[model samples]
Target: MAVPGWLDDTRTSYDTVAVSYADLLRDALAAEPFQRGILALFAELVRAQGPGVVADVGCGPGRITGYLDGLGLDVLGVDLSPGMIGVARRDHPGLRFEVGSMTRLDLADDSLTGLLAWFSLIHVPDDEVPGVLAEFRRVLRPGGVVLLGFHAGDGSRLKTEGYGGHPMHVHVHRRRPERVAAWLEAAGFTVEAELTHRPAPDVEGGFVFAHR
Candidate 1:
């Protein structure tokens, strides 16, 4: 099957800036109590259900994946960009990292117990999001949990440059929490919680927790 143009662009762009991106955001969550609390909440929820596999899809550089692992979750990281995966592996030598896309995951049916797609969906156009959610639902078990982090807003913008002026060609799609929840519902997941936080003055972060 042929890869979509946008997906290719996303992969290439991330590949180009993987190192710089990793360096810049490695300690990002340490300063954000709210975001850390949200991740902790997600980890706590997963831990309450007993032992299970948790995957950080689009886990750029594996920073968050490592965090979850430190919290005692059997976590693995997956990303569309090989460059990112390489950096992730190098940074967290103890963790597992794989090159994969959320649009078409290589995971088996109902194989995952928990999944996180933090700020990764922003690169996917709105129309393609439903398909991605369907893929998520397909890979998760009946009671599996999903946590999505994205930019909260109502538009898409082309990001032509990234960390340290690295060239990129990707669209950053900001989406509303309600819109994401609607998509999740259509994909057969029950929305459990939604969080909107202003990590920056101009940027609102959106998080939605759901279960299948």
Candidate 2:
């Protein structure tokens, strides 16, 4: 099957800035108490569902994946950018990182106990999000959990540069939490919780916790 143009563009854009991106975001969790707390809750809930793998979809540089692993959940990192995967492997040698797309995951049906798309959905076009959400629902077993983190707003923005002033070619799409929750519901997930926080003055971050 042919890969989507937007996915290709996003992969290439991240590959170009992977090293700088990893360096900049490696310690991101240290300052965000809210995000860390939410992730802890997610890990605990998913682990309670029984032993199964958690795919950290679009897990850039594996920081979040490592954190989840520390919480005792079996986890693997997946990303579209090979460069990002390389950085992830280098940063956390013991964990697994693979290059893959969220819209069409390679895992077997009902194989995952959890999926995390932390700020990774922003690069997916609005029209394609439902399909990606369905893919998340497809891979997860019954009672599996999904935690999505995204920027809160409407419309998309062209990102011409990224970490360390590297050139980038990607569109960051922002959506309201209600809209995201609705999409998850349509994709067969029961919305468990919704949280919003302003990590920075200009950034309105949104989170949706759902179960399959």
**After superposition on all CA atoms, what RMSD does each candidate show versus the true structure?**
2.2, 2.2
After superposition, the stretches of candidate 1 with alpha carbons farther than 4 Å from their true spots are: 1-4
- Of candidate 1, the 10-residue stretch with the lowest lDDT total is 1-10
TM-score of 1: 0.97
Go through the candidates in order and give each one's C-alpha lDDT. 0.91, 0.92
Model 1: how large is the Cα RMSD against the reference? 2.2
List the candidates' TM-scores in order.
0.97, 0.97
For residues 1-212, could you state the per-residue lDDT of candidate 2 as single tens digits?
Answer: 12258888999999999999999989989999999999999999898899999999999889999999999989999999999999999999999999999989999999999999999999888788889999999999999999999999887878989899999878888889999999999999999998889877888999999999
Candidate 2, residue 8: how far the Cα is off, in Å: 1.1
Name the candidate that leads on lDDT: 2
- In angstroms, what RMSD does candidate 2 have relative to the true structure? 2.2
Candidate 2 lDDT score relative to the true structure = 0.92
For candidate 2, what is the TM-score? 0.97
